[model samples]
Target: MEQTETPPPGRRVALAVLGLSAMTIMANATVASSLPGLKRHFADVAGIDTLAGLIVTLPSLAVVITAGLMGWLADRMDRQKLLAFVALCYGLGGTSGLWAESLNAILAGRLLLGVGVAGTMTLGMTWSADLWQGAARARFLGLQGAAISVAGIVFMLTGGALAGLHWRGAFAVYALILPVAVLALLALAPYSRERRRAAPVAKGMARQAGFPWAAFAFVGSLGFVFQAAFYITPTRLPFRLEELGVANPLAVGALMAALVAVSAPVSLAYGRIRRHVSAMSVFGLSFALIGAGFVAHALAQDWHGVLAGSVIAGLGMGLSMPNYTTWFLARVPMAMRGRASGLLTTAFFLGQFASPLVSAPLVAHLGLAGAFGAVGGTLIGLGLLLAVAQIWWPEQARPETAPAAVS
Candidate 1:
């Protein structure tokens, strides 16, 4: 058979993928925002309280298991076809949350949702890398990060709006978007079922082994702060406000939404930013803001303090988040992008997975103020650690030489 010339993903294809991922971000926001509402439906089910939160978390757990496989498959198969098929899980999983009366069904749906997230999240970067190399690819990937952050803001607010109507209404929106994703993907974009690459040889594996792994760990640690702050904050914020005599859940949601809204533009700014600053500087600044903000929140004992922390953290994440994936890829061979995506995403979500485990213990021992300070302290410590590495380890701080694309 004759081989066809590699066709790049046009802006339309990128937009469609962004649409699919925006829903994933929304699904994430829904579970975070709507957990209290889910309890009522779970009342008759056994183990409700302990289990309901897992529904929100199981997707990240799934990311750890599946992200690498999905990333590898993206590099080895027809990525667009894989994208369209996996997107169904995202829609279906959200729909289950809207409809499921029993706890078991919801858990099952959450697992499926994780599968969808793994596919989209990994492909978003690797697919872009496949389409464009160097600076252009970097900008496009930054745009994708911006899209997800904006969706975080949109879905957070949307979930809050629907909370008054009923929590199920928030998830029901996923059903509407899924079909639109299907149409946009199938009709507007062109991807064949076959991929164009020879298999990875032993030398390919050796090149992959030499990748910059520390950046993966450092950036992944920061991801925990991103998803955790948004996910857990929304869950607890209303109660925190209510305890302090604030009655409006909508207002609390709005506050979370506003902070989350900052992430997108900040993410977009990375494209311009990578031109001037080193990725290490971006990481240091973002985490420093986040860590300092948390300390500020601990000190304020008021909502203004909380908002200040959120704003600072949001600005920091926007700068740092997009660059990590690009920076991670920059240090690796192209053929390994899938494996790299998977490994990097796993680190990212694993941080998400650790959020409650780490935060809940602190809150139990120290109270919310202590908990914020504790989390903030950890962030600050990590920031300092990264700064040290950048200062001492010039390789991570400087631009990378192009390694061979995995053949």
Candidate 2:
């Protein structure tokens, strides 16, 4: 793999931006460890079970609704300013829970946090597309996944500890984004302005080429399924653990951390994995691992078995996430990266928002283990179908094109 050298402040700045991107995951997972606490605190609220779940899903819902518009703005506006502004909002919205006295107010804060997430996520990947190319791009995307996994462990543990003190304490983790906002302003602002001036016409040219609607749809659908499957752990596992006689938030955090911790190493190995397998094949393998993990979870009679299943699913998550973004980036032209990235973000989070709804019925009828078995079976079937399709239609499975331009 040829490494394409990027001009200017180089890998240091790129790494900083990537580090900031980890905050997006923190916003979601940090709250997971706090869910049990929140549920207890708001025990009087009607339908509290569903409302407690909303604390986690609301941000994703906001992301799904707003990411496309944010992406569109990224292509036409100043990305640095957009990112920094959103980072500020992310901190404020996420931390609003600390002072909010009512459930509705807290939900409002999560909604605002979602808007911030939509922009930061859309712009973060667009920046990667703009700054690097070839193997470096692939490596950076893998690093993005690694960073998110590492952040998940740290934030989940922090949130769990804080939740033990008070549910509001976990909300304080959102305040970390304030410093990240400052870092983005200092590191990314100047370079972003320079890039904007150099390629004022890139957006128009990209529009002229027409959006790759078919490719966007394909990637979006795949993202939806993968994310829904991945979300089953954070959204439902705490409750599942309770059913198996583990009610401690810290223990739940550790188990969830184990899942993401396994993912970190696998994500870092993604560049190497791509060396031996086509992106399509990698996708197939990811689904297979996820399915098998779910099956393991379904059959678990104890938390240890659940942990094993989580680790397996984490491997699938680590590989598939980077693969999805890398595959989308490769297919889209430079001008369309922001919008395309936004659509991908929307699809992924939409799946997150839908995970509970999709699984709750199964939880109601079949129990958690049975739900896992059902989802696992579906994913394994999907994986096998994709593999067979790849063999039968290699050309469609692996389309060739000139490398994306490094703007």
Candidate 3:
């Protein structure tokens, strides 16, 4: 009997995978600039201020709620097909605001959009794990982070432009994903089926070792903290700009885009940074940068001051995603990748959902600028603590080797 080798994932497949990666960021970013518009449109509703923030974060809450199931499905189903289906859902759910007649209707749409995000985001990470390993995987994850940052800039700008026209116009940006769904089906379905047949040993090994709950909890906590602090950009920055007397949605979007723009170069450099630095140390540095950026925001007297803070915070954003993702993926077994990705998505977005909840009270007491100051101070302290721990207990911060490749 002769055995055939599975073909490598081609460039088309890589392109498809990268495109899907962008969707995870797009899940909420496309509408962030629209929040002010949404609030104005629905001003008559009860609790418009808080509810407006929810519009930006509702998908995150949805992702938190649905990610576990998405993870379970990722392990059980044909990943390519599932990705296609979910991409379609992203388009439909994301665009719902375009015609949604009331605030409640738009909220319902955002909930559905979150469900789609859970599946797409989980699958993107799972597929990346499936297709690459070791340094190559690290490099690719860095590139993925870079690509996501670029997408954030585009989505933020587009959403802002649409919001300028009307708050509902931004929802049309989601319709673009429908084509990406087609590309995923065409590019990935056949390759994935063949790979699954070739990787039975990996599945069995994963089954035997079981899920790493402790490691996941540690990594997930990192994700949660990073996102909670970082999400302040998308959730709070627009309002901060408003207070600065910048009212145009396009200008708001551009400033928000600037926040993401600075992250791209840093993300592109992450693979090299990992070679010299432990993941824990990398995280510490990222926290410090983000903290400093936020403090800058709190101190901003004008739009230029806010922009400077955004650029600084963006650098931290660039470093954090690849580190958290690479740290966890290196430790997990093949069969458990989907569940692992699911856990990551849940933790990250759960933080996003919590940001407003945690910060709103502070805002009431301290004012918006004061809230930024408080969060910034806490993050800076946490970063220092992490750096100290890494130095004193070096073993805790040592980078882990990825599991040997399954040939």
Highest lDDT scorer: 3
Give the per-residue lDDT of model 2 (tens digit) for 1-407: 11245553566687667767788886576776677878888899999998887788789889989999999888777787787778877877899879988898899999999999998888888877667665566677788899987887778778878977887899998898877777777778777778677665766666566677887788789889988877888777888788888898668778877878898889888877776577778788899999999998888888998899889988988898888877777667677788888998999899988887888998899998888899999999989988897798563322122244434
Tell me how many clashing residue pairs each candidate has.
1, 0, 0
Alpha-carbon runs more than 4 Å astray in model 1: 1-9, 32-37, 98-101, 176-232, 235-244, 395-407
In model 3, the clashing pairs are none
Best by TM-score: 2
In candidate 2, the residue pairs with backbone N, CA or C atoms under 3 Å apart (3 or more residues apart, or in different chains) clash, namely: none
Which is the winner by TM-score between candidate 1 and candidate 3? 3
Question: What order do you get sorting by TM-score, best first?
Answer: 2, 3, 1
Question: Global CA lDDT of candidate 1, please?
Answer: 0.67
lDDT of 3: 0.81
Compared with the true structure, what per-residue lDDT tens digits does model 1 show for residues 122-218? 7666655545555555576678778887777766666667765886777676675566566555744444332343334523664645655675565
For each candidate in turn, the TM-score is: 0.84, 0.90, 0.88
The worst-scoring run of ten residues by lDDT in candidate 2 lies at 395-404
Which of 1 and 2 is ahead in TM-score?
2
Better of 1 and 3 by lDDT: 3
Q: Candidate 2: deviation at residue 262, Å?
A: 0.5
Q: Give lDDT: candidate 3, residue 132.
A: 67
The stretch of ten residues in a row with the least summed lDDT in candidate 1 is 396-405
